[model samples]
Target: MPKKFEEFKLNRQILNAVEEAGFTEATPIQEKAIGPVLSGQDLFGIAQTGTGKTAAYVLPMLMKLKYAQGENPRALILVPTRELALQIEEQVRLFSTYTDLRTVVIFGGIGPKTQKEQIAKGLDILVATPGRFLDLYLTGDINTRSLQFLVLDEADKMMDMGFIGSIHRILEVVPRKRQNLLFSATMSDLVHKIAGDFLKNPLTIEVAAQATPAQTVTQKMYAVPNFKTKINLLAHLLKDDEFKRLIIFCKTKTVADNINNFIARRFGEDAVRVIHANKGQNTRINSINSFKEGNVRILVATDVASRGIDVSEVSHVINFDVPIVTEDYVHRIGRTGRAFNEGIAITFYNEAERYYIDKIEKLIRQKIDEEEIPQSIFIEETPFDERQAIAREIDAQKRKENPDFKGAFHEKKKQYTSPTKKNNKKSYPSKNKKRR
Candidate 1:
């Protein structure tokens, strides 16, 4: 039997908000993480996305904070991406609604003046991306001396995004004696290293092995022949009303934009939206808000932009491209089957992507079921240019694994041809004989 939220002995303000938010029972991660957090212990949590990890940290932090106090923030939550920072800030607001705790979210891609003004007005909790947080701290807009609680959410993603230096800088600025909490979906080596720097004898919690997908999500894959076939299959899938709310994850911004344009043309402009690093902050926010609010039926995005944006009851997650980073496969599919809701994750891959699929399966410790594409959906033949591109990519990956292995594109060096014997003798023998 699972424990109820009441067992955690949360304060009335937090309890009311939890109830108002319609969460009666604690998730596995939440149940396990809350107690340690409330006890003011340094904690390192290993839990996947959609495991209620946000509330696991947020609820207890709220309980610890109780009510807002001074001008400087007491609790600081550092996230890897702007999307995550905004999402955490939203969670802070939702949970802290019944209390007087004021929260602000700060990230880049926008003017700092507004954020500085918000900081000036005083906040109890600050959720920020590393660069923006450090910027404010360096400019004296944020004071870290009074910080009591330091949380690094999505620590693995932070490391993947190359925020280690910024994280180190932050660790230096914050009070050395403060409580630390580090949460990540996967406990990679770098995550462990950073955790060593942040946490002090932390209670380690692992709800599940890292990189495992939620059981509620049915995973399957289509062996697509080319990009056009992926688009065709995507169109086929979206025709079903069961996939009313969907997110298509692409590997790069260029791919994301192309997919978004294709989807927009097929479905009306209002029916589809896209988000990536190149998008304006407001545009990204509005796109996410629209998708969350169900005003947009589909959102095409890159992996980085999709981090920390949560929408409950997402019908499906479609991987338009195989993620080179194997761990990201788990995060991408995690967008669906959230909160124990049944959902589906469909992946489209060509032959070249098989290597990544194998890596993903190995990391997750499970095989993704293969699905045969229906004959009605035309499979585009691999064009010569595209074929060569894929061959080169595969060859490159092979070379990384085995430097001595020559690839499909590798051609034997042309045999050096010596001049004909008679011609060489005629040209060189007279001078050589004279010298000899």
Candidate 2:
């Protein structure tokens, strides 16, 4: 029998909030994680994404943190993306609705003035991205000396986002004796290295097999030759009314923006939304809020939008481009098929992407069914020449309208590398010079 939330010896106010929020049984992660966390021990939890890990950390943190003071946050959660930060904050809010556990979500991409004001007012729990948190700390806007719990949520994703330095910065300030929790969907050597660095004889819990797809999701793959053909297949899938709600993942923000523009022009603007790291915080929040409430049917986004998306009823997840990393494939499809709900995932692969298919399959330990294209696509589809012409025209228009759009993390990294005194290009440190 699974442990139930009501069985825990928690404050009446928190129990009331949990009951009001419609939670009864604890998830597998929560069942295992909550006990150790509540015992005031460090933890290293390695479960795949979409496994209710947020609740695992929050519930116990809330229970043990009932001594919750008014202003400075007692617990701190560091995540990689703004979306994940917001999602975690929202989960904490849901369970602590009736309690006095004040929570705040913090990230970059917006002015810190508002966030500084919120932090000054006091928070019991602070969810933040490392970059923004470091910035705020450096500016003396927030203090971490009172923090009792520190959580590094999605630590692998944070490393992938090049935040190891920021993590080090935060580690310097947080109390070393505090309860530490490190959570990651995949347990590779790199993740394990960080976990070992932070945890001391901590309890480790894993709910699902690492890198495996959720049991409720059915995955399919389509092999195509070129980008143009992939675009045609995407258009065909989008037109199908069977897909009530869909999320299309692109490898690059440019692709997401282009796809969003195309969908917006073909369908109603209200029917499609696009988000990425470059988008303002309000735009990202609004896009997700609209998509959650059924106001928008399709959202084109990059991996930045993939984390901490909590919509339970998303009908379909389409990978417009295959994720190069095996771990990302797990996180990408995790956007759907949550909480025992069934979902469909479709991916487009080409010869260059065949390597990715092998990696993803090996990680998930399952063979993805090869999907047969709809006959209607062949029947009504225009000639290849005409389609290519139209596609090129659309591509040209997008280029003209949105010139110099950033592609992916790597692309943006290259574009923004500081110029050297010798050349107007990224500078590299001399090996002779000391790094420290």
* TM-score of every model versus the real structure: 0.93, 0.85
**lDDT string, candidate 1, 215-267, tens digits:** 89999999887787788889888888898899999999999999999988888
Off by over 4 Å in 1: 410-436
lDDT of 2 by residue, 133-218 (tens): 98999999888888899999999898888888788778888888799999999887778878877888988887888878888889
Range of the 10 consecutive residues with the lowest summed lDDT in candidate 2: 426-435
Clashes of each: 0, 1
Reference-based TM-score, model 1: 0.93
Quick one: how many clashes does candidate 1 have?
0
C-alpha lDDT score of every prediction, in listed order:
0.87, 0.82
